[model samples]
Target: MNRNDTPNGSPAAPQASFSLRQLSDADWARFGAGEIAYLRPVTVNGVHAIAIHGADGAPIGAAPNAELAVAAILQHEMAPVLLH
Candidate 1:
């Protein structure tokens, strides 16, 4: 089963994507700005690395491996997603 699946093979309920309590257009634009981050594979100075960026495409950090990349993202309370 996938991450959104239940033991019985049913899909789980969807989680909230953004807050309804947002106060303005700016708030909507930054709905997941800090909560979700993307992991992109990159070559830094001829070395393989993972670059982490916020949902808005701003750089946050990087790591030599995916494990460390994920750990760093989680430590910052953000969800990590792999980019294709």
Candidate 2:
């Protein structure tokens, strides 16, 4: 049987899902003002890295670990959130 199919041939329940929502005008404004940042775990050259992204979805910086990444973002007066 296919991975997505149950024993009886019915489709299996989804394991996980998410919805993307567009940012509001005020959100964009805050981003432009450097008030927000997002920290996402990433892999670089086969090594783990933390990628910092601006609210506008642009890459801001990266760090070798989450602690350093959060410190960097806070030092710049921006909020950091982990993306999983």
For candidate 1, the lDDT comes to: 0.90
Score every model by TM-score: 0.64, 0.62
- Candidate 1 lDDT, tens digit per residue, 8-36? 98999999886787568676558689899
| Candidate 1 local Cα displacement, residue 9, angstroms | 21
lDDT score of residue 13 within candidate 2: 93
List model 2 lDDT by residue over 1-84, tens digit each.
998999999999997564325767676556545777888999988999999988778898999999999999999988788888
Q: How many clashing pairs in candidate 1?
A: 0
lDDT of each: 0.90, 0.84
> Distance (Å) between predicted and true CA of 6, model 2?
54
Q: Model 2 segments beyond 4 Å from truth?
A: 1-33
